[model samples]
Target: MLVSSIGASIVQTVGGAVKIHDMSWVTGSGKTMSALLLVPDGASADDKRPAIVLAHGWWNNKQMQDSNYVELARRGYVVLSIDMYGHASSDPLQEGHEMDAATGMYDGVKEIASLPYVDTTRIGISGHSNGARAANFAIPIDDKAATPLISSVYLVDNDPIYTDETGKYVNYYGDRDVGVQADQYDEFFFRSYDANGVALTAPRDYIGTPNAQSFLHFGADPSGQAARKPYTTYTQSVDGRDAVREIDNPAQTHPWGPFSKQEVTSLLTYFDKTLGAPTAIAPGSQIWQLKEGFNALGLVGFGMFLIAFATSLLGTRAFAGLRAGPAPALVPREGRGLLWFWGSLVVSAIVSGVSYWIISANTAVGTVSFLGDPPINPQGAVWIIALWAALNGLVAIVIMTVSYRVVGRRTGVSLRDIGVLPGWRRFWQGILLGAIVVASAFLIVFVLAYFFTTDFRLWVIAIPTFTPNKLAIAGIYLPFFLLYFLANSVAINSFNRFAIRGREWGNTAVLALANGIAPIILVIAQYSHFFITGELISGFGGINSIWLFPIVVILPVAAVVTRKIYRATGNPYIGGFIMACVVTIVSVSNTLTYTR
Candidate 1:
């Protein structure tokens, strides 16, 4: 209760400082777009204010930009954080409309511009990642329109300022003040490439490149190293307005850029320079970090709530029979037994790691691919994960069967001791209980979103409320997830159930590592190599599979939760089902959705 209250309160406090509303409107293309529109107190036609339109990249929604919305609005800028087309709470992308001007950013501009309290000539636009690409696309269209709407633009971790489609670099921003928040370790952009189409240098080396020099000098060649330096503001006059251009390189990865203080400071400084802030606060005076801390607290609270809720339900009369009488015996820690145990774990982890990389590299989910196009755009990534999980689950089944024959039969370990003999009736009841617990948890998610306009999150790991359509999508992926998680539960409860006299938590910590270390290592190795050498390490997997980074968090939590739920119910079904359902919902809802 304390954790839940603190998380909700911090969000409310931040939002209450401004009049925040969850709003949606129909775009020109006949699709609905959603946003959180924040109007500062005293904002009215009598007291007009500068407005800023914000957008998040692929696989994210409006809430992903909450820090910006809260900070900008508190500083007296009317802010509209949008759910980009094909992302959370918005209609799926239609064919031939994949890049609709700005993926709804153009619409966001029109909406904010139409507001009564907004100063028409003082509007700015900003976006991150693919959203930055959308902003890049929107600026030109808005600038060239009969009456231009945007006064300034800021793009984060996007492609080059000028696109070289016809073997000629075309500058899109005609006269709008532009700022680029280029991060040093961005995976996609701002780098010189080698012969095999690999980035030879990191983004920190970007300012010295021909592209950066040309852009910073406004299409002129820089004569000296100082002329191509970063963080220096440049200006040119066009059509009676000063078109300011500046670039700030923060030492961060593409995803990490949005969550950094350095990036936020750059934003504050840029917007203040171009559009001007109503309150002249220092760029370094930031409150977004406080909210972020509370968000992490909320994430912990969410995990605790799930286990607490499940435990409470298992104590009820309907679930009382599901509880087991005694704890299962641990696998022996003596010499040969220990070798077999550690060997199986190492082999399983390696298989899981290798299989995930191979499947992600090979699987392509699209209109023409074997999996075809899913209704939700991110289902392509989901299908890859499902195939990986299903494959691992099969291998786990084989490992467990062989281990039981080789070790368990001789040691007097029964199928019941391994949690595999929960009778069919009890198994069905456990599933029912799991479903009930998950349903209750999501009900809380809905309430939190409705009341506070917030959900439990810290960066890409989020648990947001989903539309009914997501339920149908979750159903399709649940079985594939279950095959892995249920098998995972058996492994954790049976094989790795260590008998530590006073270190129960040590056991959980070991189990968590056992379950998650492979993905953790993959992530660490990928980024570590990139940071050290300025190039991603070779022959890991498809870059698209970087989406699986969340698995590093999910698997460890699942391991811990599986053990906790097993302790409460003395079986694995309830916990496995719950994890599968929750993960499927989160995966299905947080990504892009495509229209068939």
Candidate 2:
């Protein structure tokens, strides 16, 4: 009931003042793109409004832009947030589209312009990261036409307007009002390097660099000019067109760029000046944080719902036999026994962490001959994580084998104690229970998204409903993820199941830490180095390792759920299957699926 209320609240916050539609259309290129179109209440062809096309970065979809969508639409600006090709509900990116300059931004702008309720002459385009690249790519293409489609462009955490390939300034935006929300610690863009490829200075000093200087000065030489400042709009007459350009440098990392209030304020202020807001509200007066806060609340409700729903299913006659009592022996909480418990946890963390780095560096995420058809595939980030989980699961089996021989055998810990004694019938029952629980959770998610256009999310971590294609791909990778979760269930519930007589919550907390500590440490170490030294850790498997952030969030929840189910069933199979099914589906659904 609480989860349903949270879902309804999200609906009111997102759609109360504006109507959001899950829409899609084929572009002139014949490729279909998905978008969330937010049209304000009472908007019509007779009451035309300025429109903005918002795009998210790579591996993300239109839902990621909810903050922008709700705020802009509430202020009477028509907003269309699109899922770029190969991401979310959009079609897989087709062949030769990679070489095409504007992947989907041009199409998005054109779509908004065709709307009867939008002012075509005041249409704008904006994107973050690769989305910013798409927006940048579309500007010149639009400008070359006899009647351009866009009047303004905002590039967030991107570096296209500053210079061309050879580090020379170029003004290709063709006099459109432009604003660049450059971040000081952007991992990907806005840097000057020496001839030997070493960075000359930190990213915070970017405003004084030649790129910023020329960009602010309309691509003119800045050798003898006054120091250019950031966040100050400058007007220029270029190619007989009136244009304004500004650069706002936020003290944030690349991923956090869009989430910052300062970035959103910059977006609002720039559009207010360029396309003109129908309702004159202060750019700083914002309510998008309310939207984000509720979205985060939905994430909490989602986790609670999963455990509650699974527990309720276990109470029914169909699944009653799946429940078992606690193991015969608990790992001693004192002396040498305690040492073994802590020692195994440390070992598990190291094995999992090291395996993550090795697999990410060695395994390619795209289609492979060994995984069946390269075209109809479960590709990209899904493959990287599945391979990593399989590797750690193999290591876990070895560790469990040695520990049983060395200590568990004499301690009266049997295979049954560790949850390996389930009969064949019970094993099948566990699978069915897991499937039902996962399907019910997604059904609720789909209903919420279909009605309210919101899903459970906090920043980059999201639990959205998947297409049939993603579900098929999740099946392909399930065994790999299941192996890891099953082993994790045994290890947490048996090997390190420090079941204190009066401290059940503490025990579950410790187990959750043990499950997620390795990935947690990896994320900390990588970003710690990046922030302090201004460089990624050497060969830390590049930026792709950052994907582990979501894993860090997920594994702890999985650990808690595993313990909850273990307490009810006296076995780990049901919880293991549940985690594997949900995580596998999430991994495949939220990433880039390739057509090739």
Local distance difference test, per candidate? 0.79, 0.78
Tens digit of per-residue lDDT, candidate 1, span 409-512: 88787887657888899899999999998898888878877776677777778888777878887788888999999998888876667765556677788778
Model 2, which residues run further than 4 Å from truth?
Answer: 1-15, 99-101, 164-168, 194-197, 325-331, 334-336, 360-373, 376-378
Model 2 CA lDDT for position 221: 75
The prediction achieving the highest TM-score against the true structure is 1
Query: How high is each candidate's TM-score?
Result: 0.94, 0.93
Error of 1 at 240 (Å): 3.0
lDDT score, residue 468, model 2? 81
* C-alpha root-mean-square deviation, each candidate: 2.5, 2.8
Name model 1 segments beyond 4 Å from true. 1-15, 193-201, 220-226, 328-332, 363-372, 375-378, 541-545
